[model samples]
Target: MVVRDAKPDEQTVTSLAAAAGTAPSMFNAQPWRFRYLRDAATFQLRAALDRTLPHTDPHGRALHLGCGAALFNLRVAAAHAGWEPVVTLLPDPYDPRLLATVRLAPADAPDQELARLHPTLTRRHSSRVPFRDELVPEPVRARLRAAAEREGGQLHFPSIWHVRAILELVRDAEGRDRATPARAEERERWTRTPEEARTATDGVVEQVLGPYGGYHSIPVRDLAGRHSAFEQGDPTPFEEEPQLALLGTAEDRPADWLRAGQAMERVLLLCTEYGLSTGLTTQVLEWSELRWPVRDPESGMGQVQMVIRLGYGPPVPGSPRRPVGQILEID
Candidate 1:
């Protein structure tokens, strides 16, 4: 649908922000704000610090990535609306709050790719359960990698040994968090019981909780009670065989994180289109101690930005998203 008539208006900003909300955050934090100048038809976005994950993402790297993902969505929506989005990343060094500025440029119709991927935004939810034994074909892998590259990141599927090392890193991180006192407090604060009052506009929820009592390769971020009925069956062989893809960038920066976020969303949306379920795990990368070594020396792949698991499985139920009106303000 067209977001603007003769020129950019409130509708353009509203539609773009709603579309952008589909981009994933580290914890689905959806931390961002958009300001539209009607006369200039310029859309400006900034990171919403209140949604920042201070405990896990102190550097604001993930926050920027989340915002960047939203920015990418804005571009796509603009294209779908027959406009090319002109974006300036981190446009003003003095005003770091200005993450990006996008002005719509006139364009023809949106292509089939945009049309196909558009619907997946609302349909795409994180799947935390172990995927069925459906092997992802190399062609599918190549397409996912292409999706990442389109938004300026690289997707790498690890070799067997590399996958083993990555799994070990994840296990070590999970074990460390399970023991730390701060981890307990953080989890308690962010994870709501099925009946608990919801917090702010962010975080994983009980519905996205992985099955309990298992060593799954792509474990869900535990949000449910230890004994909740939502938990999956006993840890089966599928636990060791989850599909994994490593997302990376040549250089790491705020802009790079933003690119990675967009790439991430693209990959996830493409997965949804392909009838593949998907989830993300950044636990190991969340700890700086564990992230650096993820770069492979032999292949020259840079440090990993996101670790995603994908396969055919049931889709997770929809989670909460603040109303479009709530996420937008017009002046």
Candidate 2:
């Protein structure tokens, strides 16, 4: 496919790809690859088939979601660099791994809206630590909801009852994961031991996983694997009243997952910009039986893409990312 777009410099291309690589993914799986067409000036985003979390993310939905977040970052970075990025998703049915393509053209003017988010791309980290028990103001909540809508998604702050139900679902899934043979295999596959984390560039490293027990029915995924929900360290008290937001799309499909991923990162970056700490609660969302119940029955929202925890807290280290040379290629 050809478009009236200009090719970016090699240095600029790498910088943009670096920003894209920072987008959050399931388990920090970072299941995305990039190919820059030197002659055509187009970039292709692909799903690294090997990085799939088979047990937790069957059907490659999480792969698409993670790649979608990376696509969003690529756009933001391109915009910041005074180039307009043209994107095409799933361009070839025959090439299922090809998630998207980005072509950059010099912009007549800067996209300030997207450009403003550039600083936040690297600033956002998935904080697994305990957040202070404080309520997010209504104005801030409204801004987050709007951010989701801008990218074809909805963000709903659940009622107290709904929050309780979702938490229960997460606990149920974690219990099953502990007992299921395949789940154990998958968990062990991504979890790096404390000693192993120093060198490993991906997966849930021991450094980022905070602790074992927590209070208030918090739905944080127990990545502290020692054969249980949480078996690593002392109990860490989360917020007494945890604030939860569900990001959803109107439909459930590969394309919808991509949009939702973009929306999820947009929300996360905004949260970072607003000086708020956040963590993802996908334990319930990962399981099909539990994911649907996460939606508030009263709400008209569609498929729940992600569940986000928002509040004030210490910004803990996030999972490591693969090297750019490993994930991106220039042709």
Candidate with top lDDT is 2
Residue 122 of model 2, lDDT score: 82
- The models' CA-based lDDT, in order, is 0.75, 0.84
Clashing pairs in 1: 211-232
Model 1 backbone overlap count:
1
- lDDT tens digits by residue: candidate 1, 140-175: 999999999888899988776777777778877776
Where model 1 places Cα greater than 4 Å from the true spot, the runs are 1-5, 109-112, 197-201, 213-219, 224-237
Models 1 onward score TM values of: 0.89, 0.95
Per-residue lDDT tens digits for candidate 2, residues 1-331, read 3234566789999999999999888778789889999887789998888889888888787788889899999999999998888888889999888888888876787678888999998889888777887889999999999999999999999998888788888778778777778877887788888888888888888778776654336677777554333543446677667799999999999999999999998899999999999988877877788888889977799889888999999867767888899988999
Model 2, residue 48: distance off in Å is 0.2
Model 2: residue 299 alpha-carbon error in angstroms: 1.8
